[model samples]
Target: MPKTTPTPGVVITRSTLHKAQELAALSYGSVWTGPSGEESSGEAVARHLEATAALLATNGWDRIWTPPTPAQLAEADAAATTETMLRQLLDYIREEERSASGRLTAGDALNRVARTADGDPDTGRIAGDVLDLVVVALTGHPSARFGYWSERLNRTFADITALLTAGALFARTYGPAPERAA
Candidate 1:
């Protein structure tokens, strides 16, 4: 038998995409330099993946891509290995940041997101601005560079999980379909 597709309204919305894109931008950065005077690309990639994963977590498949059955939701959780990996990377970032710079203020860390594209109605523009700041911070320093990168990744991950959870709950409370028969 041919497979049947779910209804159109059952998936994630454009606003969700905008939000993910914003979060992703905030997460990209340069790699940290170890004591040996070398940088690790793996760290950078980890941060990127973590940010992407967070986006996924927040705007889960059902909310951002399509409406999934219970089985599909379970599969999504299984596929989210990125979340675990990102968490590890974040720990590394935090350690480095603490060692290199003592401690960074919240305003210093999230300033990028707050200052970009004032008065612009486009959400994407704001997101892009936030991303640029992350990129600058990651590449700018030698000591705590990796830490900044890792923290952004962790933040992204948190954003994703929160969004996904919120989307799921929203659907349960307000989705169009009647509750499925047990």
Candidate 2:
């Protein structure tokens, strides 16, 4: 793509780009801390944990059994026999804006810029240049995947991503996994 220069003052920082990348890692490992400083495990995770513990306690660590429900059996079968849900999901997101992945407006290009660039700056001509380039590059693409976003949205996603990332990193670094927390 040809270079795009933003109208003088529109700046998109590298940190902005980094934030976008982090938001896109939503499915990484089922581990993150929430804002309340509790285990990231909420109802969904708790159910999984409870089910697993019941299964282990009922049977034993060495035992394995078929999933109890037809729905579960279907899910298991789909694991190998079906097209990954990602393709269907991406299509659904594009058509209906009804998926979690659609929550991201432009993380991919932002991540590309952040990863390809180095030594992110806090302030100066280079910072301005990088941000301006980000705006231009993002806007250059059509309203397809990873396209333009308002700076505020980009910054917000970046911050959320940063928090989730820090939560995950600190949890792993400073404490045991939730099962071991007991």
Candidate 3:
């Protein structure tokens, strides 16, 4: 008989399985920390199992298990797979908005002008030209006002993309750094 190949999108690979196990172990340790660690094992394991089941279901493996009722498996199947890219994009936008609002609040006249202008006075004529390009790209219009706002949004989006790219590069270069205290 020919060697059987794994069906596409059916079974989780060994590496994925190992990563899941590592995540589960980390989650278990975090949950079971503190003075009552002994008391939290059962609850932690239950949570871990639920998470594992949801992960499996999302990856289309819920049908492989025999004991769980169809209804239970169906509920797991409905669990959402993570959308990290969308989440990261939204987070970057929020951060940009916060930074913009902060600059505006500080009464920085130069920043205010730079933020709204068609072109930067200090940064050469490229700022205005870039804004014009963005406006045309965004609205398909030749109007100055549309171009101005479109430029603002485009600049903001570009800044955000750059920040996220830099952040990822830094994270990759440094590995996972210790989290800062709140």
Q: Write the per-residue lDDT of candidate 2 for residues 1-182, one digit (tens) a residue.
A: 63344343334444534443343233243233332334432222232223323333343332112232221112333554346566565565555433222222222222322332221111111222222333333345322122233334323433323322332233233333446432
lDDT agreement with native, every candidate: 0.33, 0.32, 0.29
Distance (Å) between predicted and true CA of 111, model 1? 21
Runs with alpha carbons beyond 4 Å of true place in candidate 2? 1-101, 104-154, 178-182
Instruction: Encode model 1's per-residue lDDT on 56-112: one tens digit a residue.
Output: 434332211222222111233455589876776677666655545222222232222
**Number of clashes in model 1?**
7
Worst 10 residues of 3 by lDDT: 101-110
- In order, what is each prediction's RMSD in angstroms? 24.0, 20.3, 27.5
Where does the lowest 10-residue lDDT sum fall in candidate 1?
64-73
Give every collision pair in model 2. 12-131
Q: Of the candidates shown, which would achieve the greatest lDDT relative to the real structure?
A: 1
lDDT of 2: 0.32
Question: Which pairs clash in the backbone of model 3?
Answer: 118-128, 119-128
